[model samples]
Target: MTDESAAPVSSGRRGRSGGGADARRAARTATTITQAGFIRRAIKPYEPFTDEQLQLIEDNAEIVLQETGIDFYEDEEAVQMWKDAGATVTQGNEPRRFRLRFPKGLVRSLIKTAPREYVQHARNPANNVTIGGNNTVFAPVYGPPFIRNLDEGRRYATIEDFRNFAKLVYMLPSLHHAGGTLCEPVDVPVPKRHLDMIYSHIKYNDKPFMSSVTSGERAADSVAMCELLFGKDFVDQNCVMTSLINANSPMVWDGVMLGALKVLARANQACVISPFIVAGAMSPVSTVGTLTQLLAEASVGIAFTQLCRPGAPVVFGTFAASMSMQSGAPTFGTPEPAFVTFGAAQLARRMGVPFRSGGGLCGSKIPDAQAAYESANTLWPTLLSGVNFCLHAAGWLEGGLASGYEKLIMDADQLTMFQKFAEGVDFSENGQAMDAIREVGPGSHYLGSAHTQANFQTAFWRSSLADNNSFEQWQDEGSKDIVVRANAKWKQMLRDYEAPALDPGIDQSLQDFIAQRKAVLPDSMS
Candidate 1:
């Protein structure tokens, strides 16, 4: 199938040229962001666990929390809060360590105050995403230290790369959230980079975004920046930001994460209480064992958020991956992890909270076949498992050590497909197409029929990065693979990036705040 609306390809040119009226028109049209809404899933989620099985997991998780209590290391405030909440707190073997065990159903009762669903308001109201119920929000890759592309093989990510990614994600209509820490800007000082990352999200994109979670001070700084942009009153009353707070696996809630959670929760910002589990390493090797541990860890983290402030929004998140028994390297897109995601979603729903897990996760070092297959495997389960907020939905590569430019484009292209798929079948009057069938009786063909002409343009989803032309047309137009096409596509997107309008006063205030913070905060390379 060919689109007549598409600009005519010049056989003489290898790649699209930056000249000609038709070419310029097409470029402008293509670069314009499509008005895609957040996915409200029409299909039912895939639930694999029986009621008995789910109860068993919950029972085991409560036992883990009660018997083998979680250690809150180096946070007296957190320990005191637990003690105040009726939990049994005991002195730990090490200094600044405290173990707190909840009675049966205590964690569950505490988390009951969290909202089942809530809106994360974007700078543009139209871009606001609802997390919970049947909605699914997609965000780009987060927390990669290095960047990779066809041109630049692999290198430490810089602020420049971080901003470029922000621009790309903003342009891609499929992605709903401007993810936090798209990549670590190693070029900037470690202490000061969070300011730049937070600023990039506010300056480059208008979508809902995450704030810093490195420390309580940085988290407070994030809330302050939001107050500058969205007003302190509004920030205190509404959910404007959603941040990631991972649990140190093997049942540990370290001070760093607990402190960040407290800051965000008190400010009414959403927090994803995710457990970072690598099966057989941080968790048990068996799927059931891993699920039990994930529930226990997530329970404590989510409950802690409610303790900070009742009714603060929190997601029941789990990041579980299987590890190679021989090499001890983490694996992704495996069946066991998929099962964990499926089970965890069920568990989250039972606990009355939004679920967060799954992404375009893989262990591949490059955007090759391994990356494509592994990413697809993970993404399929993510949608089916009813993931509410999907981070790392695009641009993941090298086991999440590096972010791939081509891979981001490729993953986002697939995300659009997923969005379409989540809509399910139309089944409307037009979908039946009885008129078109009668007009093209005896299988003559509907290509020229009135109904076909009217609906053909919107009927099928078109891929921006895929080449579906015949071999002759493909070869004539420079037989480029998906990776090469993706490379060119991202460069073109950056070239056409247009920053969303921000109030001059607010922008200046943000700049001043960053300047003041940098002046006071000591710079560190670590």
Candidate 2:
């Protein structure tokens, strides 16, 4: 997230000395991407529920755990852990599915070992991000199987597309983490895709990144890769990666997610115990009803991580959305989900863990007005709710089905605005500007005042995407829309991107490890 791009600021490649226009273009593109610090909220979080109301929700969640129970599917070890922890277990109708009913205080007791906040270290120390407390880390769109651009429409993503998005995230200052699974690289063999995805994140960006949770084996591969990049000792003591482990909604934790969670917890890595809740389908339709289910579900997952390894880092993550009653399609940026996020954030703080939710979410099929409006709505709640880690912060489109090229640029531009807003109102002597008031007293303008001259360049946040020029000037400049401007911005970023430095010996070791793994593993398409 910091501007420690392996290369120095003045070392960017320049154009050949041929023409004045070419030299000017090189100079314009040569400026280094500036440093961007992760946001730490200065304003208080917007907690929607009173203490008594929160207690009611908490009590209801315990009721659900005691009465309805949660299911652990196809993981005998997980079931055994819960049974050992004093939870009542019953065999489910389906094979390998067991219902776990915990006593009121058991889950809370197990979660006591989790750290309230932890630093996820990047290769460059400057890029390290704090997760939890008042901090907010912005990561790019996750789990989009398709990539969309104006020129090509939408298509199943390839590894090339994955690398392209990684480079974009590396260059975009607003994105604080090199997100996992930027887009599903469908072209690669399904079994081996995680390797490529993990490699792409490390090679393209030095910032903190996520691990592969598609399977336990893949998660191990991610750890091994990190060991090669960062020494094994460093990997063992520090959190090099933070992965997503989601629960199956309606009170179920499947084998795949449980497996990945166990690996990460045992390795001392961080994982977000998120429930993929789509209200009306996955959980209850009512806002309060959904909050109860979310708390109950996330509690079980977070407790299970502690069961795996005490003092492991975990996040109380919720991916909540509303389903359209008529069409059954999921909706984003709705009031109901915002309410759920606010309630869930308070619950996370009460449980003494970091919260993760919201993003530039939208159900719109393209980067049009609907996309902008929905993304804006979701982003506002995300910041105000005190979300500690925001996945899908940029580049999401079409209800999380695609990663839009233009949308990422536009959303990143807005992230800068959020960073400025998070600083709250500055109250310094310079900020007060008493001298400016005196200099421009009574009807006189201050644009040319002494204080104005001193602070003119830093007075306001500027948009890199929005055009505020005169109509005549806009017409003369071709009157491009934001999307068009964003498209051009991404292209220029990729062209200017320089890969972060990697030690040759470590890089070779990683290559050898990957080659050995690929050689032994079958080329199974699945």
**In candidate 1, residue 210 scores what lDDT?**
98
For model 2 the TM-score comes to: 0.94
Each prediction's TM-score versus the true structure: 0.93, 0.94
Best by TM-score: 2
Question: Which runs of model 1 end up more than 4 angstroms from their true locations?
Answer: 1-32
What's the CA error at residue 250 for candidate 2, in Å?
Answer: 0.9
Q: List the global CA lDDT of all models.
A: 0.88, 0.89
- Model 1, 1-526: lDDT tens digits are 1111222211111111234454445334433456588899999999999999999999999999999989899899999998998899999999998888999988999999999999998876778899999999999999999999999799999998998898889889899999999999999998899999998888778789998999999999999988888877878899999899999888888889988999999999999999999999999899899999999999989998999999999999988689999998999999999999999999999999999999999999889999999999999999999999999999999888998899999999999999999999988889999999889999498899999999998899889888999999999999999999999999988777766555545666778899999999988787
Clashes of 2: 0
Give the count of colliding residue pairs in each prediction. 0, 0
